[model samples]
Target chain A: MNLLHYLRALRGIATRELLRFVHQRERFISALVRPLVWLFIFAAGFRSTLGLSPIPPYETYILYEEYITPGLIGMIQLFNGMQSSLSMVYDREMGNMRTLLISPLPRWFLLVAKLLAGTLVSILQAYAFLLVAWVYDVRTPLEGYLDLLPALLLSGLMLGALGLLLSSFIEQLENFAGVMNFVIFPMFFMSTALYPLWKLQESSDLLHTLAEYNPFSQAVELIRFALYGQFNIYACVYTLSSLILFLSAAVIGYNPSKGMMQKKGGKQ
Target chain B: MIQSIAPVLSVQNISLAYGEKLALDNVSFSVHSGECRILLGPNGAGKSSLFSLITRLYDTRQGSIDIAGLNLKRHSSKALGRLGVVFQQPTLDMDLSVERNLFYHADLHGLGRKQAKDRIQEELERQAMFERRHEKVRQLNGGHRRRVEIARALLHKPDLLLLDEPTVGLDMPSRKAIVEYVHQLTADHKIAVLWATHLVDEIFETDQLIVLHKGTIRFQGSVPQLLDTTATSSVASAFQHLTKEVR
Candidate 1:
């Protein structure tokens, strides 16, 4: 209704998420641990076998840890976005989403606000993961940490918007495992999260083109450049456009009158 | 009989269809301030579909609904602001404390901090739940949880209160308490209520009743009028006599 009203509602929605996140210690632990295990165990083993030439963000050849750090950060956000969407699915199933949907606020605004709340949580996780990566000697220039903030915000929103898009389509909680298999794995593996596009090209031109076009790859590239205190206009533009595309589709998909989620949930 | 100076809730020629199946056909109702109008129907009698229409969970394809004089389609914010709902299923976050849940709802409605606090306290105290405000909702029994939901719904001081089978699973004592409390609410606050239920025993003598069967209204009037028309001695028999055409 007013600016203050909007602010208050956003604060409430974000605070509810924070409270829920705090209560789920297992969730926080799992989110953090998933990325770390890859950084430590997976990257450690791959570091020797996966020698890389200097990528755009990298001036010299780097270890697999450095190469995959941005990928892992992308991984954190990718999973966080889906995790947030999973919560939305859970809320719909549990009837809590109806409470949110019934709020006097505009539904698009509520959903966008929900998307933003999830981005905030994922950013926190990104920074925590960065902290651990720094401890592992995958250090960025000191200013890169500050520079990474906005990048994390942008990439986080894109991935969270993707999650919003997915949550809008997913009807039940039981379909979560299937979504992870279909959405998460393909997006992660087919992207530059673990390797550069050129490397994929050396292996397979088809996979290389796919990785180059992958929005997750662009998000990782965006983060990869930012952490080195550089800016990739291409990655920035690609990621932003993808975010807009995903968010628009998500908002439309959630409309009661026209969207695919027209069937009321929780009664079943 | 349900109309007042102006209806708090007005549903005009509302019909809902799921593919070829008509869930509601030209159903219409209005509730004025201080009126408790019951939508009595067996399962799949279009009660949920109608509630979905009122709540804007589904689009109003063939009709319009106005709440507190604001069109739900054109001015949903204002209309929704004047509405309070306790859905059929539990919607509270099990991990959040009672006050936390209520406060979050208040925030969603954009209630100011002081106003939210005061209303939360008043509503919780009214439900005899102020003492347990710090307790998690998961700790509350089914009846108590329902009470908390009712309290939360009333906190906004809505002009129209829609309860979709709020007492479905409660024990008799709890159900009776909620029924009595809601009746008092409309009386004391002049709020219009649309309570959907299948159980006949939950009906109060003064309440206006509408019996729905197969997506159409079978009967709607006073209890005595229902008996008079059906030539039956009791509400249950009258309901049976009215809906006996089910095949």
Candidate 2:
């Protein structure tokens, strides 16, 4: 295909996603409310009990809200990614996906376009959350706002790829809610989103190990460092590798011949 | 009509299976330009499987399919570029205006902005939907939605159009309107159509017919020829006569 054609397809797909997001006012509100509730009510309850040791980014101990801000940003992306995948399943059932797949473009390119669109939406939601955090006085360094852009984008793509992979395997919409709860809860609770690794270790050795290995924790750390205008090499490596891995799996899962959907008796 | 013109769609001995169960067993057919061919089959006669294969939704494992002189397997982009499809299920984005939905399809086909707008306007006006172009698809009746889908499918001017049971849930009048529209397209635009459905009423006496049952073609000819072969007076009884052994 011509380069102009590919570019046009990308633009069309992205614009369609943005239009859908705009129409679903309730979805946007709920995406914000979930993280805002945690930032306000949950952080308020834990503020007194939680203590932080001086870390590289933090010269001194920080407030609970500041500490959890990156995690909640990560939360917004995580949920948005899963929500986009839920819509993919809905699209498949509703037949809109058939219209998309029948286009002359390569299937992988179409899927990546979808992934990029979802990531873009998640990033927009992350920025909205950041603005809300700023309004709540849980502000980062002013320069850190720009620095966090790349980190937030990478995290959104990684998490959205995970959602794409999950949607390809999920058979029905009713089954997706359970899968979302299983995935979102563990990935959030076990990560450093709400608690530091050392805190997890103090709670249990298994929890500490799980937190260390959790890709979500690495994503949060990447954002945490970027929000302070610093780089965490380990976090960057882990997040990039996970993004590649999940994205490849998603592409494979959407393949018409050997994909999970084909194997599961989709539209035969 | 030029007698030497190549068929718009040529399927050669395509066979498909899901594991050990055969879904389409060496099915083959061709539709020449300006012809409207009907693939008449019951719900489980593998009509959908054949469409899936032709559309490349499923792989062609045992045979080849050619669209407008391009092989589906080797030259998929060129082949698919010449094809249009309206699936059994409604594929419109309910939240978007009808015009926006058509624009998306146009962009996917790589039409430039000006060209896409012109084609979209022409197709919508032809389909009698230009007045309702700003309305969300959810607000339209089922028949109007199907018309919009057909308009979207034609935006790229594909030479071959495939409709997989397009009238499954429509009322009698709506069904008649769509069928008549497609018939008119072949006469006016010289576009080849493969219209798959089990409904006998949709088939005209002069149209070509392929009757598939249990993953094989029981008959392939005109409606009159099918009636003559079965010694039956109507398409319905001829279909029953042809499939009764398998049933």
TM-score of chain A of each: 0.97, 0.97
Chain B TM-score per candidate, please. Answer: 0.97, 0.97
TM-scores of the candidates are 0.98, 0.97
Please, what are the lDDT tens digits per residue for candidate 2 over residues B87-138? 9999999999999998899888889899999998999999899999999998
Query: Model 1 residue A59 lDDT?
Result: 94
Docking quality of model 1: it rates as medium
Q: Tens digits of per-residue lDDT for model 1 on A39-105?
A: 9999999988888988687898888998889999999999999999999999887889889988899
* Stretches of model 1 off by over 4 angstroms after superposition: A263-267, B1-4
Candidate 2 CAPRI level: medium
lDDT of each: 0.90, 0.90
lDDT of 2 by residue, A202-268 (tens): 9899999999999999999999999999999999999999999998998888876678756654353
